[model samples]
Target: MAVSPELEGLRRIVPSRFVSFSFPNPFLGGAPNPYGDSYAGECIRVAVLDSPLPAPSVPSTVAMLVPAGRHRDWIFSTRAGHLHLLLSSTHVSRFIILGPELSAPSPRVVSCVSRPEPDPAHARLLPLLLALCPAAAFLGNARHAVPDVPLLTFHDDLLRLAPVKVVAGPVVGEMVVEDVAIDCAPGPVELRRRLRFKRMPCLVQTQVRLCPSSAAAAAASSSLLEALDGSGGLLQPEVGGSLVEPYLQAMVAGLAVIAPSVDESIQSGVRPTCLCAGVGGGSLPMSIRVGLQFNVLGVEADSVVLDVARNHFGLVEDEFLRVHVGDAIQTIEEFSRQGEADMNFSAVMVDLDSSDAMCGVSAPPLEMTHANILLSAHTILHHHGVLILNVMPPPADVSFYQGLVDVLRQVFSELYEIDVGNGENYVLIATVSPIETRVTDNSGQFLTELRKLAGDFLEHIRKI
Candidate 1:
């Protein structure tokens, strides 16, 4: 199969590093053609100018320029006129290209266009062109007519179009902390803080590594500590800061629905207070304190974990936000003994997780769910307060979940569960008093109310 003179001439001036053409197989005499008989045997080729590679005998269905490295400059240079002339003379019907680099997880389509109709040779390619880029439109016969909306809108940031080179900086700090009460293995554990990022140079993530070498640590878990913005400040709560985890968002949603008294307390010029257990990275408590304007008391069993939260995750302690480094269970009991007038809380949030994989439950440990602890947690709440728990049951562990729910029913008059839909975690909202509002009966109405109360916080919750 020799190359056609016309295609060879077009290929010579296209500035492509790789190009390949595909023609219908002649052996399949009666096979159906997706693009109809008019283009059944017509040859099609795709060219990408970025990387150097050998052309394939049979190429993929569609290949569009990704426009990275030097190719981006070429696409935007004065030579674009020559590229437009080449496109008009060739059989290619569409071109999909990305705009300047963005903070998004993946490149977003900026421009996609096809040639106008009445040209049968290009019609077969139209269906695929439209499918790949639903925003595709005809730009007369000139490829240069394609709009550059994304580029123009972000013109000021175009300087950032240069590729970011991410190099993991040296460990900023490290420490060893141990607490037997929590689920981690019984040994000295080391935590190291380092910087990591995807593409955006301004958006850097501070991650904490906990005992990466220990077998027990591997069996237990690890997590991202926090994300920071360009100004050396934590990113907005919605970006990667605050309660972006689905289960945490569900817990916030539960809090919004069951604790209406928080609003009243705020209106009366008194800040509502919440007690949060399991202060991993302190995002949960900080979100409630800053976003909802509540006075938050965070309790973590290990002081080292609290230190990591403060030193690495941007957790700050103020008059309104305080942290207690000790056993959360004991703290709850002490609060219960203090009498409601002196130490009543608007909400009690338990977000602890078990270190033992065989424990059958993933979160808030079995002890946090003990009948005594539940009673104590119920005792310290304001008369209208709510208790929110993040519980993760082993897959299809029906007996464990049902037993936990049964125990919860014994402690609270009303129990509601929000399925985070992640298959593992569920946020349980328990109230000492019954919910009287008819809106709770309707699931849609309940979500609507939650949305209203949560506002921007709801953006992180998935599946409503």
Candidate 2:
């Protein structure tokens, strides 16, 4: 066959030095040193000559000229009745080349040339020649061999990667709950159910907006809820059956610190219980009940919010999880009056937002943090129980935050803060009984512990 333009161009620039080799005649049954003993078992490059040469009499003998070099090899062999060329640097004992026809006078030639060092003038032409060749390059020295990777596709509608039809539905229901207007909309999928709340304007006329609540029925699905006021937003999804919001995760981490006591209570034939003061869409309390296996009692000032949680966000009430439609502070005070024997809790979580922007804070209305209210909340917790509060103070308002911390200190001996890194929310964890060693003192250690607990919780829930 005539030499192609790519091969001819390569032959013109490659070095002329070569070591010729040929297979011994099979009929004679004697090994012949075709090239010489010096060239044996050495890495070499090869070039085929188009001109007729003395070919071996063997029926299927291959004759080639090799050059000494440390370079990749471009091998040409027949596979499945077709000629295939592969670029590889692997060492092999022998190679077989099969074809339909063979001749002694003239034989097909394959050229394997070493890659030349970079030259400014030839750099452009080199890539063109390589592009024309039918070969695949592979890393010979890779630590692990790459397996065949099937092409990924989104053909299945149920696949996570599949395109979703997100048609925004109209407001199916609306109601006024405690001066806050609540609207429910069924988003694209059952997993994306949404509830939007608009609270009354603050004294400064700044609109107090509440983040939307979203539910994900599927374990892998997720959605983001942008703050209507644009201060910040929430990632409202139950990821792998665990809370996705950073603030909520921080609150859950507080529960993790007292997990041993909770486990002990469960072992003693009493279910560990938690009080969630602000059950916006009931995600936090639901996660506590389902993910951590704790019985949760949730209190919300507005009954309409609870209806939204049940109708849209998958809030189901059973023996372990229940909600009360009343003032959270009043509920805490009532529980305090009942005494520890009647209604003590293992943990208490407060996630309320302040409608009064004049207070320079965005969470737990000032009344919720009053000295008396804090004392009442503290009294309703078990001795080793923890109180977790989600607070959002004005940016850089250090004095306001310090004042809030001082008030919390009056009721609890131990106080720890978890920065959610969102610039908007911080989780405060306090306990009546001091912890000997606090993991929250070190942020890295705290996060490591939270991750470990979350992993275990997710694994346990998945089994059920």
For all predictions, the C-alpha RMSD in Å is: 19.7, 26.2
Task: State in Å the error of residue 122, model 2.
Answer: 52
On the 0 to 100 scale, the lDDT of residue 23 in model 1 is 31
State each model's CA lDDT, in order: 0.49, 0.47
lDDT of 2 at 30: 29
Clashing pairs in 1: 352-364
Model 1 lDDT per residue over 147-201, tens place: 2211111111111121212223122222221111111235433232322221111
Candidate 2, residues 340-422, lDDT tens digits: the string is 57477889999887654223236767787689999999999998888888887743244667778999888898787777776
True-vs-predicted CA distance for residue 420, candidate 2, Å? 0.2
Winning model by TM-score: 2
Runs of candidate 1 exceeding 4 Å displacement: 1-242, 358-361, 395-397, 438-464
